[model samples]
Target: MNYIYQDILIENGDVVLDAGRNPVLIQDSAVIAQDIKHAIIESGLSVALIGEKSRDGRADLKKQIELLVEEETRLVPGTVTLEEPTLGNIWIFAKTREFGDLQFEVKEVTN
Candidate 1:
């Protein structure tokens, strides 16, 4: 199967197909953890594909959702703010140490 990293759409464990018929997987926990780390280092954001119901007659498809991002929060300096209605997501923030290491803090935000 081929992987499309930029914009992925998944509903639970299902893969959403693209125009070119490329297969996309939801990826397990281990892969997801690594993906989040890479995304934070590379783009400052981690994106995931979540399966959502299609209003139309098409099959259920996944939509790209931000799993983590620096600006998702109201974005106070040294802080991240997320505006979620149900607030079921967990976010983690990390600061880069002088030695090029990272120190992390986990926050749970709920509406």
Candidate 2:
């Protein structure tokens, strides 16, 4: 069986628009990437107080993200690491049954 996923593309919290002002579409890895990114953002907001200052905190956040993504999307999560804690940079690695390996980053902005 062939499985293909597709959705309207969104960028920077806004729906991407073309020259004709039509919503752009994305499929496969792009769709999955957005899904994972949304999951991470939601997880971060849900656990706003959880800082990645300690190993346990990082692990907890990672687990939370994994659970969220797994429950929300088709991607199977791999390793979630805080590549740069100062800037709130998080790296996520996951894969879908149809789309091999996937990697992306989510950055948390603080005031």
- Cα-based TM-score, every candidate: 0.23, 0.69
Best by lDDT: 2
lDDT of candidate 2 over 8-111, digit per residue (tens): 98766779999999999888888888877776776564245245467776667666665666664465544333333444666666666677777777665444
What candidate 1 gets wrong by more than 4 Å, as runs, is: 1-9, 24-79, 87-111
TM-score of model number 2: 0.69
Error of 1 at 94 (Å): 11
Alpha-carbon RMSD, each predicted model? 15.3, 3.7
Task: Give the per-residue lDDT digits (tens) of candidate 1, residues 55-90.
Answer: 331111111123344433222235333232222233
Q: Please give the lDDT score for candidate 2.
A: 0.65
